[model samples]
Target: MTPKLVAGIEPPYYTAVFTSVRPDAPEGYAETSVRMQEIVREVPGFLGYESARTPGGIGITVAYFRDLEALDKWRLDTEHQAAKRYGREHWYDSYSVHIGKVERSYGFERE
Candidate 1:
């Protein structure tokens, strides 16, 4: 499968990088993840996101936002909070979230 790469975004945005180690038995994880992705799109300052998971159960999702305020809204979203709780209880064995500002970014694509 082709990896999805977020492109054309200007600099000075914020990114929330979520990395996780999933448990062998991931019951509701996939559904919740899809729902969260849908929900984030409705947020005011949402830019775009890129995500991928390895066969070994390690996953990373990077969500982009226009600025810090938009990132905060996502952090405090009610449904997202619930999803986080559920993931902690049932889905993720371990996880980490890194939020940072992208002062500059560049990329190249082949035709």
Candidate 2:
């Protein structure tokens, strides 16, 4: 399947980059991941997201938000909080999150 690339995003936005490694037995991870994706779209400041995973169990998800306040809202979402707990307890072997402000972005696509 072709991964969809986020487009039309301007600078001065915020991004939450989540990098993780899955445990050997990742029970419920896929479902929770899908749920989180759905929930994020409902967030007020949500812009878009890009995600990829390697066969070696390493995954990275970059979520875009309109601003810091919007990013904070997602950070404090109840369902998302629960998913984080579940990931810590059951799904992930390890993970890291980095928040950044995008000053500029550029890309190209061949038509």
Clashes (N, CA, C under 3 Å) per candidate = 0, 0
lDDT of 1: 0.89
- TM-score result, candidate 2: 0.93
Supply candidate 1's per-residue lDDT for 45.
92
Model 2 spans with C-alpha error above 4 angstroms: none
lDDT tens digits, residue span 1-111, model 2 = 656688778888999999999954477777887899899899898999998789888999999999999899899999999999978887888999999999998888766
Lowest lDDT 10-residue stretch of candidate 2: 23-32
Candidate 1 similarity to native, TM-score? 0.93
Which regions of candidate 1 deviate over 4 angstroms? none
lDDT of 2 at 84: 94
Using all chains and alpha carbons, the TM-scores for the candidates as numbered come to 0.93, 0.93
Predicted candidate 1 versus true structure: per-residue lDDT over 25-96, tens digit per residue: 488777887899898998999999988789898989899999999999989999999999988887888999
lDDT: which candidate is best?
1
Which residue pairs of candidate 2 clash?
Answer: none
